[model samples]
Target: QLRETLGIELPTNDAPPTSLETATPTQPVVPQSDHQCQSNQDQSPEPLDTSERQNSDLRAQSTEPLHTSEPQNSDLRAQSSEIIPVSSKEFMSVSSLIRGRVKLEDVNKTYQMIWTRFKEEGKTDPLTPGDMYKMGLKVTGQTGEAKLKVLRALKIVHISNKGAVKLL
Candidate 1:
């Protein structure tokens, strides 16, 4: 009676109402332009094997070793080998100073002396704290164990649990 009054079509008793959950288009959707639809249909996608072959060809082309002259390589080697001198004062200043009457200059000097001695002797093994203390005392004359603490705090040297002291 309402459909008739409003002049709107209503589902008849013979057909059920179209539900949103079941509603789906039967045909495959295509672009609106006829030319685009024709072009898309004409060209099929390339096979996986053919695309893989193209990728392998590209890989083969890129696999060749890069060429470099001997002089350029030698220049690089020389640059890497060249030692850059660092100032002891600057090095000391960069490290955190351990307070308690141990002078930074003495520590630096002691470290230099020990390093020079190590180099002179061509010593590969780690030095004992006693060896370092003797070497440090001879140079700096800052007696006792406080010098070792300063070395440790500044990270200039590392003392192992076994009392082996090694320069960092």
Candidate 2:
């Protein structure tokens, strides 16, 4: 019944053992001297035709310099302004403080605190919603959604439907 269900036929007790089943374990082969190892190394297989083509492609790519333009002054300024530097501790505290009662004045103060912390840390990148969540900020659920809406209304932060947070 089990063999039928599994779609496999098991050998009966009366069946003779196969060569594989009768085989004995053997010791692994190891080179006894460096001469044998050197001979083995000398017999290295030639590179495949596909590998040669890939190598040529890589060489061509390496010869071409990557183009990267400098960020515009306005773009730099906008990016710098958008990045709010709040520590994980401050973020958690502020999130908890504004949980049930979200006041604009309190939110503004919290933003200032975060900005100060960010400056102290010297991080210039904008904090994403994933980063905030990692720092213990719950940006899901009913309360989390409400808090995000309040923060957005006050122009403190913008939370995208796709879970991205941009601090303004």
Q: What's the TM-score of every candidate structure?
A: 0.36, 0.31
**Cα lDDT computed for each candidate against the true fold:** 0.56, 0.56
Model 2 lDDT tens row, 27-96: 4445457675576657878776988989989999978965659643334434674544333333344444
Model 1 is weakest, by summed lDDT over 10 consecutive residues, at 77-86
Best by TM-score: 1
Stretches off by above 4 angstroms in model 2 are 1-124
lDDT of 1 by residue, 1-168 (tens): 898899999877766654543456774545457775476658798766988999988899778765745543223423543322223553454334343465656555666665565555657677775676666454223333456556565555577787676655
Where does candidate 1 clash, by residue pair? none
- Cα deviation of 96 in candidate 2 (Å)? 19
lDDT of 2: 0.56
